[model samples]
Every structure is written in C-alpha cells, then in structure tokens.
Target: MKVLTANRLTNGEAVWLAGDHSWAVTLQAAEVALDEATEEKLARAGTAALLKNEVVDVALIDVELDSGALRPVRLRERIRAAGPTNRRDLGKQAELQIAVAA
Candidate 1:
C-alpha cells in the first residue's frame, strides 16, 4: 500500500493526505492507496499541492497495515511520522503516546 505525504509549506510540518481530501498531521489519518489507480490519484493530488505551493517534499510512501495500524516501510519515513527525534515530548511521538495513555 501507499500514502501521500508532504511538508506543509507554512510550518514545515509533516502531513498526510486524508480521506476527506485535507492535510492531517497523523499518519493514521492518511488515506491508504491499496492499488495503482489510487496511487496514481494520490500522486496527482501531491503534484497539484506542490504546484499550488501548499506543501513541499511531497512523496508517495510505501506502507503496511500492521494490526490495523499504519507503518511506513522506510526508516526515514518512520522518523518523519514520529516527528523530530531531538524532542521526544514534542511532535507526533508525544501526541500519539498521550492519546494511547489517556
């Protein structure tokens, strides 16, 4: 499977293309493409977003659904999903952990 990802131009935050056709911070909210047609559609949307200057570093990421959870195949994408490693208390890492704990 695949999912579209990009950095929001305004804040350089890693975001995913959601099912509602909006940008979302969490990878879990990203719309998963299970086939070529969907991947192509996501690619087109990513290109459009890039041209519109709404985001940068747009990419289609390889992913898997592990026990119904999203998991990026690459280490780099994993890091990106978790946010900056320097501050564990910040970004998606903290956000996800907090939600789980709550």
Candidate 2:
C-alpha cells in the first residue's frame, strides 16, 4: 500500500484513511510523503487495513486519492500494534478447549 502519512499541516497530528470512508489518527511519529497518484493508492489500502484491522506501521499508511483529507497524529508511533484479529492465538485457545473436551 502507498500510504501518504504526514504530520497534519494544521494540527501536527498523524492521520490516515480508515474503512467506511473514515479517517483514523495513528499513534506514530512518522511522516508519509507521496505524490498525487501515490496518495490515492495509499488511501485505498488504508481503508482496507482498517476494516481488517491489519497491523500497519504509520509510515506504511497508504495515502489514496483523498490523502489531503487525512491528518497525522502522534499516537501512530506505538510499536507492535496488533491487527484486528489474532488467528494463531485463537487457534491455540481452541486447541486447548478441544483437548479438554476429548
């Protein structure tokens, strides 16, 4: 994804595109720069990431066609941000339950 993450020119916060045509403020301190076309690709990717809750770095925030609307935030800097789901963890728990049942 081509996220165009940058400090908001006005508020100095990190913002990126999210799912449902919404924007999310990231907790990172990275600047994402890109051209007009690159911004579009990033935005689209950001939207997908949000819905999936995919783990993404603030710098990796894809800036899409409407990159201008996103604002960067300070919170985007948090390390090890998990995605929307933890399949492995869930599978482990399920395995334990099955073991008990058996």
Candidate 3:
C-alpha cells in the first residue's frame, strides 16, 4: 500500500493525508492507496498544497498493515513516522505516548 506524507509548512511537523483530504498528524489516520494509480492521483492532489506552501516534502511512501497497524516499509520512512531517533522524548512518539497516558 501507499500513503502520502508531508511536513506542515507552519510547524514542519510530519503529517499524513487523511481520507477526508485533510492532513493528519498521526499515521493511523492516513488514507492508504492500494494501487499505483491511486498513489499517483493522491500525489497529484498534494501538489496544490505544495504550491500553496501549506506543506513541503510531499511524497508517496510504501507501507503495510502490520498487526492491524499501518507501518512504513523503509527505514527512512519509519524514522519520519516515529520522529527523530536520537531523542526518544521528542516528536511524534513522545507526543503519542503523552496522549495515551492522558
């Protein structure tokens, strides 16, 4: 499967394209495309956001549903999904943990 990802222009936060055509901060909310044609269509739609400076580094990435959870297939994409590896208490992982704790 494929998913669209980008960094929010205002905060540089990693975001995924949701089913509603809105950007989501969590991968779980991402809209997954099962074929290359759908991937290309989503990528094309993302171009407008890029041109508007609403996001940057927009691209499609390979992923799979592992144990009912969506996961990036490559190392680079994994890092992007999890946030900076050097700091465990930072970024998306940390934010998610905090949310769960709450």
Candidate 4:
C-alpha cells in the first residue's frame, strides 16, 4: 500500500510531493474549492483521492475567542481523505506500464 502525501499551505493552496521528492504546486483548479459538487466532479475525474488525510488551515480567518485571543477558523476536508481506495496506484504508475521489449 503506497501513500501519496501532500502539504497544503495556509492560503488554501495545495502542493504535491512529486516522485522525485520535490515539492510542486501545480495541481488542478477544481482541487482547491470547498464546494460539494466540485468535489464530486473531481471524484469522477479520478483526482479526488490525491488529497487524503490532508489538513488545510486558513491564514486569514482568525477570530477572537472568549479569552480575547485570536484563533484561526481552520477550514479542512476530513471526509475527502477517506474516499474510495479502488483508484489507480499513483506511486506504481510507471512500474505497471506496458513496455515493448522489441
């Protein structure tokens, strides 16, 4: 069982850790929205499971608590992490490929 880990910034942005062990922020547009319909579309498109166990914090949604201290709203998608596990194995994509040994 391979794992695909990524770090989402505090600004609602996502960065993927590539196979080369490098950080990249080149994800699709639909992956950043909090809309339910958008998430469904991503699931149909086979890109939903990429963000499993991902916690994203909001940088500018701080609010004053009862103690007169500011705290972040902390928007996150807990349910998205536990979606279908029947998708393709992203980690072994190259190894499962078909090579012509001519």
Candidate 2: global Cα-lDDT?
0.41
Q: Which whole-number lDDT from 0 to 100 does residue 70 have in model 2? A: 34
Cα lDDT of all candidates, in order? 0.94, 0.41, 0.91, 0.31
User: Between which residue pairs do clashes occur in model 4?
Assistant: none
Model 1: per-residue lDDT, tens digit, 10-60? 999999999888899999999999999999999999999999999999999
Displacement of residue 46 (Cα, Å) in model 4 is 21
Q: Which candidate's lDDT is highest? A: 1
Q: Which residue ranges in model 1 land beyond 4 Å of their true spot?
A: none
Ordered by TM-score, highest first, the candidates read 3, 1, 2, 4
Query: What are the root-mean-square deviations of the candidates from the true structure over C-alphas?
Result: 1.5, 13.7, 1.1, 16.8
Candidate 4 per-residue C-alpha lDDT over 54-89 given as tens digits, one digit per residue, 9 for 90 to 100: 323211112223265222233232112222235433
Q: In model 4, which runs have C-alpha deviations exceeding 4 angstroms?
A: 1-5, 27-102
Task: Report how far off residue 77 is in candidate 3 (Å).
Answer: 1.0
Evaluation by TM-score, superior candidate among 2 and 3: 3
Question: Relative to the unseen true structure, what is the C-alpha lDDT of residue 14 in candidate 3, on a scale of 0 to 100?
Answer: 93
lDDT of 3 by residue, 1-102 (tens): 999999999999999999898999999899999988888878987998899888999999999989999999998988888888999788889998899899
Worst 10 residues of 1 by lDDT: 83-92
Q: Which pairs clash in model 1?
A: none
**TM-score against truth, every candidate:** 0.90, 0.26, 0.92, 0.20
